[model samples]
Target: MIKHLRGVWISCLLILGVGPSAGWAGVDSDISSSRYPSIQAALDANPGKVVEVAPGIHEIHDTIRIVTAGGGLVGSGRIIQMDPARPIVRIDHASGATLRGLTLTRPEGRRETESEAVIATDTHDLALVDLRVIDNQTRGAAIELRNCVDGQIRNCLVQNYQRVAVDDRTATPDQGFAFRCIIGTGILIRECQGTLIQGNRVREDRLVATPEVKRQHGLGQIIKKNAVRGRIASQRDWDRGETDNWMQGTAIHVGSPETTDNTQVIGNLVERAGQGFDIHADHVILSQNIVNDALVGMKAMHGSKHVIVTGNQFIKNTLWSIGMMPGASSLPSRAAQGGQPARAANVDGGSIIANNIITDFGLGQTRWIWGEENVGCPIRFDHGQVPENPPLVDVIIQGNLVYDTGRDTLIKEGKPEVVPPRYRYAVLVESGPSAPVGLHFSNNLFHPGVRGISNIELKP
Candidate 1:
């Protein structure tokens, strides 16, 4: 665990003649919404007490900043925005503070940058619990924790945050820079230590942010027992295209590069997303998670080290399930984007991929993605390409079950140019930078036969 951030402070303002928006209890320790004009007014009192909001719509002007510590912000009502461009709440430079039972909705037609509903940065000993951000406005992140330690987001439900909410449709999914920068995640933990994000649901809406960039290293964070599903769409999106657009969000994207270490992703169900667990960190563990119905299930992009992908299920994914490619090709700018990093960095250290269930659609699982060739396999490594990237290191693939794979695993016949499909391969390791430093394979199970697994230096 990293050290806690300390000695951080933000100045608070006391709006004198300008009273709180509503009623004010005008007391300390225990405050009520009707008693205060606005939620920010109660927080400004600095009584170190619980501020309870009534069951109604509380509109605010500025970002409600928390500069003091040791209090609670509890509301059974909704916090709407008078200024849609600004955030709803911000928790900073405070500890032992609790934000619970609140529903914050962003307004429509925000012309400014991406906006987050709740953000906690550089704080400790905080808890965000039982918050329902429902029918949320566009560009909504229920909670975003940055440089925060000893914080937890528990039992929260953030639903129906549209990806983009402007009048123009200039940016398509192909031009995904806006999505990468928007505050569209259910929860985003960046450059934090010892954080626990448990029992949260980020459902509906086909919009998200991908930190595939090389910043914000996360440490000692655990994302467990959460359900990140994109099976349903908004009424507006459903009218445009049904399942075609419903399953189009990235469930979880971890980007630390060298900063994030020893992070754990466990016991989560990610379904109907465009991508799942797109990771670019080191010493990460992805275990006991369910990844299904996506273009790419999981990936180690740009560059990574010491990743263990085990005890998981990759089922019915449209394209290659797991891939090891430079992330340069996956970001907003690619080789074609002039100066942008084309792929992720290089990979190093020993890794393990074991004891997982990887399934294919027998013969009918064929789709072209990102303008790539059609594929019906679970695992992929760059095969026999030129040696431009760094050499891949030691790998061990063992004790995994493969079902109905070979039908689309390989080319069927002799022409070699026009190839047909066959149920032949389960794993494909082709031209890498160089021969792997050490490669081992053992005890793999194939459902139909054993013809498709290829390119193993050391075989079972």
Candidate 2:
């Protein structure tokens, strides 16, 4: 099946005239760069043809929607400026649509809400490869792939995003200077099967810019006089200069149990995202990814089954490294709200968490996260949230190194919050009257020390 899919992908690329790229002749005829002024014009003139963009900035006013089989809109050294109202590239119900080597960006503007940079819904054999999405300001996710089949987003770089912070700890608009903090996911794969998201990197903490980035979309303004709180604030000082606190979105968000059943997220680097990978899918394999600096490392909600989280280095996350809870559509804030309910009632089948190194949790965070009903905990098995069903049938937590900084374990002792409900624990199981079934906690190394004292047993 894998070989057949690869063969299909290669045949689609060849049919789109991707290979023999220099000479540029495929099954379909090629269009010259000068034939159409804008990228959309080229795509419109030749459907199912390979449209190559020149090495310059393409200011897109509207969404360039495409429906073509065995065709692509390719770019190299191309910076496509996105209109906030619309996605720069929209492929709808098309098969074999490829978008590669394009940089899509939307600078901070007067408009508060922005849509996705690229949206492909109901597409098959779609590949978004080696694309760099920089500094998008979106109310929605950056990349929205819905009901897509046999598609993959590989070797892509989605970085340096700071939208208007929804829940800023400090430096509000009333504070004189506006703050644009990091939010939103890199890609939202909703009900998409045969999808592989691999070798992608998503980050938000970027202050310095390369010459190429500055020349592309004026990213230099973020570090200068117009620097938002996220741009100028020090690592420890979230509100020092002009800080905004937003921890709501994920780097990669996978949704649905029926459509997202066979998806695999492998070898990705997710940092400083809202949630590294907010997963609600089943038969999902999340492996070999470095997940760090997020509110939560990886969240497996109520509906997820046959999920495997292994070989991942989860570091510096604030609340919980890996949280297994009932379905809430979104993360909670201090004001008392919860995510939407999960589609599936219970978490059945075998879920594996093995060989992961989770350390330095709740360190370098902007604010104290009220975890597991306002207590500081590293790993959460939340049975209290979803009272309707028995939470887990088989949960294997083995061969992992879990560590906690002093404050994360003992929140009341180490830097207690100004607010109420100060509590602490490292491993938390919120079952209330009903304890969890099929729980396994063994062969794990716990390190909690001040310098000489081994507080491993002391660690909760």
Each candidate: what lDDT?
0.57, 0.65
Most TM-score-accurate candidate: 2
Deviating ranges (above 4 Å) for candidate 1 = 1-30, 47-50, 107-113, 134-142, 161-184, 206-249, 325-349, 360-376, 382-389, 405-425, 434-439, 446-451, 454-460
Q: Kindly list the per-residue Cα lDDT of model 2 for residues 1-460, writing each as its tens digit.
A: 9999999998998777677652322222355445787777787788887677676766767777778876676656454554566677788977988877778886456223467778898889888888888776565777779999989898888876545444332343212233343456678898798889999998776522223423343321222222444332444433343222335567888887545778889999987766888888878889999987776789887467788888888887766777775543322223323774444333543788888888766563522433233234556676524334445547888887776544444455576543322224556666553344565777777553222212122221
- The ten-residue window of minimal lDDT in model 1 covers 217-226
TM-score of each: 0.63, 0.71
lDDT of 2: 0.65
Q: Which RMSD values do the candidates have, in order? A: 15.0, 11.4
- For model 2, what is the alpha-carbon lDDT of residue 210? 26
Deviation from native of the Cα of residue 56 in model 1, angstroms: 3.7
In candidate 2, stretches whose alpha carbon ends up further than 4 angstroms from where it belongs are: 1-30, 77-79, 108-112, 165-183, 206-246, 328-349, 367-375, 404-424, 433-435, 448-460
